[model samples]
Target: MALSQTGIRRWYLVHKWTSLICTAFLLLLCVTGLPLIFHHEIEELTGAHSSIEQVAGGGTASLDTMVEDAKRRAPAQVPGFLFWDSEKPLVAVVTASSLTDQQNIVIHYYDARSGAHVPAPPHDEGVMAFLLDLHKSLLMGLPGTLFLGLIGLIFAVAVVSGVVVYAPFMRKLAFGTVRKDRSPRVRSLDTHNMVGIVTLGWVMVVGLTGLILTMATPIALIWQIDELSEISAPYEGKPPPTRLASLDTAVAAARAAAPGGQKLSSVAWPGTMFSSKHHYMIAFSGETPLTERLIHPAFVDAETGRLTEIRDMPWYVKGLFLSVPLHFGDYGGMPLKIIWALLDIAAIVVLWTGLRLWFGRRRVPIEKRVEELRGGGVPEPAE
Candidate 1:
């Protein structure tokens, strides 16, 4: 089916307004996102990041020992949280209360063997922290995040309208055709359509993923208030244990409860919701793709180190889990990420060219502008 010129013009108008409103913010987001794609690699290259040594005999150090070590390193601050990495047998005890507070989390690198705090190379806090802040919220916090998300939504709509208008423009020209011999405005429009249509799938995925990421805080808040609060109510008002149980014991119990031979991957401590008050939340991963990424959080009873619940995640939780990989392009390795980067750059070009076309069309000569208003003459390009 062919679209009438009137329909095409209507779609073009929609694409123009949508793209113009969102281009600047979208461009800023893309530029900041590019560096964050390889933050891990950059951290490694800078020699500022630290890695913990694994202790032999498969014997894990006590969380109490690590906590004591961390306290000794930062005597004034109390340990707020503990994070354990099973693969490396590493422990990270966070001591920071709040960003504005004088107490800051000084990460202590430890050798699991001697429980000694190892000295780490100096890091440029200014650069790394600035990059992280820019990537997450542009330093404006939730308001900035929601603002960018709205822009992403507009970008998605612009992409759709551009595609709708492309069909009408390309009805005469074949795919990949750029009408260079035509008027300058037509040439620019042709290039915009060609680039925009070809990169549709990639741009759409990126845009939607970005929207999901932006909504993460609000979504998590809703889930916590509506669903998680209810699930956690059963154990509420119960005072946390003064003496913590062995993390290693909880890990073993969690692995034993897993249906297959899924390994216990990580453990979140008490006082934090990731870890239950009565027990450590041990996450397990299996061998298959469907199972490997899916985390089965087995809640271990804090007092006896027994597995309490081995429930699977709900559908929405599962979707949120899978969204991270799709959003970051991390599932397909470096090559796919390169392609994603190229597509992102191409989207910028589409935005720029679309803006040029819209502004160019707006500058029509007085006579032609009058003709267009009267619906009796060809639309004139703006001078």
Candidate 2:
């Protein structure tokens, strides 16, 4: 059945407004995301000194030594978190204030061998930070982040409506047909629908993933407030151990408590919440696709280093983890990433073409005319 002219016009209006509202923000995100997709490769090629692997010995370095070294470098600051880059064998002691007044800081590049502070190499902060900021709210902070998320939601709706309208638009024409000899508007509309529909699957996946990413913070907060608090309720008001427990012991405890098939790699500390106050948060990995990617965190008692719970992740948390690889195009290797990049480029072209079509339409609405100034002639639409 053919769509009436009115139906076609309504769909056109839907496409126009939806695309316009989200286009600028979506364009910025896609552009920034493109570079970030290759950040690791770019960083490697740039020869930036991000690791202390050459200097690190095989065994774990004493946290006390690393902490001392860090404090010596910045006496006025208190250590916030100690990050061990397992792959790089580098330890970073992060420092920040309890209050948000001061900008949180990380003094990176400490040589594990000499325990000496090393200067980080200069590269393109402009490009890297710009891309990151654009991806995470256009440097507009929380409000900007929320706005982009809303835009992403609209983008998803647009994708769906686009597919709906595509069927009707293509009903009279064969697949892959391009009406080069038709009216300019028809030709543009045909091009738009063809390109847009062809990339539907890819764009929809990316858009949905983007929406999930936007909700990450709120989801995490809910988990922390509800589940985590309940899980840790027994330990409430108990003083943390005066002696810092051995990370090795916590890791061992976590491994034993986790399902026999899995491997436990690292433990997050209490106050860190990545680690709970009462227990170490052990990250588990498995051999299978679903299991390997899913993180099964076991909460152990902080004072005793005894494992309390080993359980399956909540659906929302699982969704959050799964969404990351899909959104980043990292689950598949370089070939898939290349496909993702191409699809992203195609999205940009669609946005640009849509903008052009909109402006072209605006120039000469059939019912509207530009007023002529004194003795000045009115401009006419292109023949």
Global lDDT scores for all candidate models: 0.66, 0.66
lDDT of 2 by residue, 228-286 (tens): 88778887798766655565566677778777777544445566645556666667767
lDDT of 1 at 50: 42
Q: Once all C-alphas are superposed, what RMSD does model 1 give against the true structure?
A: 4.6
- Expressed as tens digits, the lDDT of each residue in 1-383 for candidate 1 is 56555665677678768988988777777777776666656665663234554454443556567777777777876655554444455555566553223224566655555555556553326565567667657877788788878888888888888677666555555788776766787577667878988888878877887788888777756655764555557778978777766766766777778887675555665545455456666777775545666878788777778777787766666666676767667566688778767777887788778778667765655345333423322243554
Q: Which stretches of candidate 2 lie over 4 Å from their true place?
A: 1-8, 46-93, 99-103, 107-126, 239-243, 260-266, 273-275, 287-292, 363-383
Q: Whole-model lDDT for model 1 versus the true structure?
A: 0.66
TM-score of each: 0.80, 0.81
Clash number by candidate, in order: 3, 2
Cα deviation of 252, candidate 2, in Å = 2.8
